[model samples]
Target: MSQAKDQEMSMPSSRQESDRTAAPSNTKSLTLNSTRSGVGTGNFGGYGMTNGAEKPSVLHMIMEALGLRNQAQNREPTSKDIGTLIMLGVMFLLFVISVTGFFVMWFTEYYNNTMLENLILAENSDTAKSWLNPDPKYDTLLKAHIFDYPNIDDYLAGRADKIKVVDIGPLTYQEHTVKDEVSFNKNFTVSFRDRKSYKFLPEKSSIGEDYVVRVPNVPLISAAGPVKRMKPLERLFVSPWIKQFQEPLFKELTVSEYLWGYEDKIIKLKSLGRGRRRFGLLMSRNGTSVDSVQLNTGEDDITKFSIITQFNGMPQLDYWEGDECNRIDGSEPSMFSPHLLQDRSTVNVFLQVLCRKVPLHFEKESSLQKSSEPVLLSEHGTVLAQRSDQRHQVLRGCAHFSLVPALLHWRSGAVQRL
Candidate 1:
């Protein structure tokens, strides 16, 4: 009985030891599972609570700490975009400047042209003829003074007495013609004057014989004194506009020829009884052409001779003046009219006639006082008449010639006249 009771006690102790060991293992496993579950819950709460007032997720916190959120939200500009903006601003500014410059230039040119035109118009308006001849003192023509030489006998007697004597008899006269043609590249001025005079006829005259002879340079020498004294006229007439561009405007005149008529007879004396008998005889044809282009008269060919004279003069041509006056429309002088005469020497005679297109402001009139309003004389807007209306009778039946080359060029856009 005692042995059996001890065996039972041993078995119970072994069972109790086993149960204790199992309990520790199970408890450790339970603790590990609870810790893992708590970690998982914390992770889920962090991610889901981003929009709420909770701690940020790991990704959000990392981005915020590095300033990546701000970097992404406000991007830095690229070099291309920055360059494009600068270029656009510069281009816009340049466009504005260019537009402004063009307008400034256009206006400046327009203003200058307008001012020049006005000045030309004003000049034309000031020289009306009615204003120039108000006083009668300006109307009278000036007469030439005459001088006489010693007779042939007195001169011969003086020479025989050892006194120096010059023969003034048997004077022969000759005539010549001068034709001058002028051209201008720009506006120019010209002025000229000429005359023809005659002396008394001898006792006997033959048909077709000139009662008066022609003389060359006689009047020029008598009027101008000497060649040295006449040099100014030569220079003024030859190249009147050489240095004219320096001036704002210029004027000039040219005389193509002058005519005169004198006796064609030569006196002869024969020594008889200490006294001489004087006789006059005809030499050449009596009616010879003077400084004029001769023309035939219809029925009066015996006693009448016709002559044609041409006189051209211009003044006050302004170069800077633009083509507002339609001056470039045709090639011709706009203001002055030139007359063509058969004999310039015979003031009362008319053989052939010519007229110039002269501006009316420069004309002299007997009706106008020394001062008057401007005289406007234009047939069309294009045709300008000479200022001297009384001196020049406007021949409505006359022919016209286009002579200005510069005006032709302006109209054609070519340098050469058409």
Candidate 2:
């Protein structure tokens, strides 16, 4: 019985060993067949092909399906690594687009605000043209107009006699009214000088005039009508910001015909020769009284002078002397000796006048009422003849002088007037 039992145990042990060995062999065969099939069909997952190792976990299976793991060998991608790579690619693409858009927007805004607007204005209107030009006629006219009074001899000598006239057509209508308002404050420096010698007056000479004109803050208005008649308030509506400088940096001098008299009586003729000249005249009102006085004359001197001119304020002639018995020839305008009027207030105006001849000196002493001492009123220069009343008046006239149109025509290569 012992022998039989021992035999049975031995048989059982052999069978167990055979089973283990056969299991391994079968697994290897299956793996080989699966790999071959997978290679041919490119379907490793479907064929249940695995390397000779433990089967992959859920994580490993997912990696293998996504091509991150090798089917021939057990391999898998980490969850953290895969997620980070996908995020990096998406962020990089977004960054590239964002950076490109920023530069485009910046350049677009710059061009629109500066270059584009100026180009449009220049193409459409002559008024938008630049101040600098090469033509001599235009150059002279522009300088004269802008600077108030240009030396006619100097300008004429530089160019031909002919003059050109420019035609400024009707004003254009605007679609919208300006709503923005601008405010500014500025201080100007005014120096006094002698009208005759063109010399600056001493600070203690009581010849200088200091004026502060305050322009209010306002909105811009349309410039559709005659610019001369346009109100400052309306102008503010069209251009909210006030231009600190409208005229030239240097003072402009302009001259005009001057008519002399108090109210109604005709007086003796006075010729305004080149430089300053003085004339003695005698006059009587209705034969009631005779008065004798010396008159300081200029090119634009007229017989019947009106003391109360309504341009700015009514400026009264402070002094006038006339002689009664002097029967001067009306046909031949009488001329007097030239003398220098030092530190004259209206010298700038005299310098700017457009006339055949300008006065260089005068015997009469013309001055402003207020004196700061050493700085005489005439020391700064003369006021422009056209703008003389304007300085004291509240009305703000259009600075666009008639000279501008003429200048533009000259600059446009047109023939001279004369």
Off by over 4 Å in 1: 1-77, 123-418
Query: What tens digits encode model 2's per-residue C-alpha lDDT throughout 1-418?
Result: 9999999889989999999989999998888886676863345455365445354577666566667667666445667747855676699889988888888888888965454333221222331233111122221110101111223333346664443332221111111111111111121111111111011223322222121111111111112223337688866653332233232222211111110112211111112234223211111111111111112212122221111121112122211121211112111111121111223322211111121112232335434445523222232123235354433332223121112222222345434332
Compared with the true structure, the alpha-carbon lDDT of candidate 1 equals 0.31
lDDT for position 322 in model 1: 29
Query: Model 1: what TM-score?
Result: 0.19
Q: Which ranges of candidate 2 are over 4 A from the true structure? A: 1-76, 106-120, 123-418
Per-residue lDDT tens digits for candidate 1, residues 1-418, read 8999999879989989999989999998887885566552343442432233456445444454545444334334446545665676699999999999999999998986564343231212332222211233323221221112223234334443222222212322332212112121122221112122223222221211232222122322222222335567776663333233232111111111111222211111113234312211211112231222212111222112111112222121122122332121111221211221112221222211123322222222234544775343323322333254443332332222211112111223212111
Q: Output the lDDT of residue 317, model 1.
A: 15
Per-candidate TM vs. native? 0.19, 0.18
Reference-based TM-score, model 2: 0.18
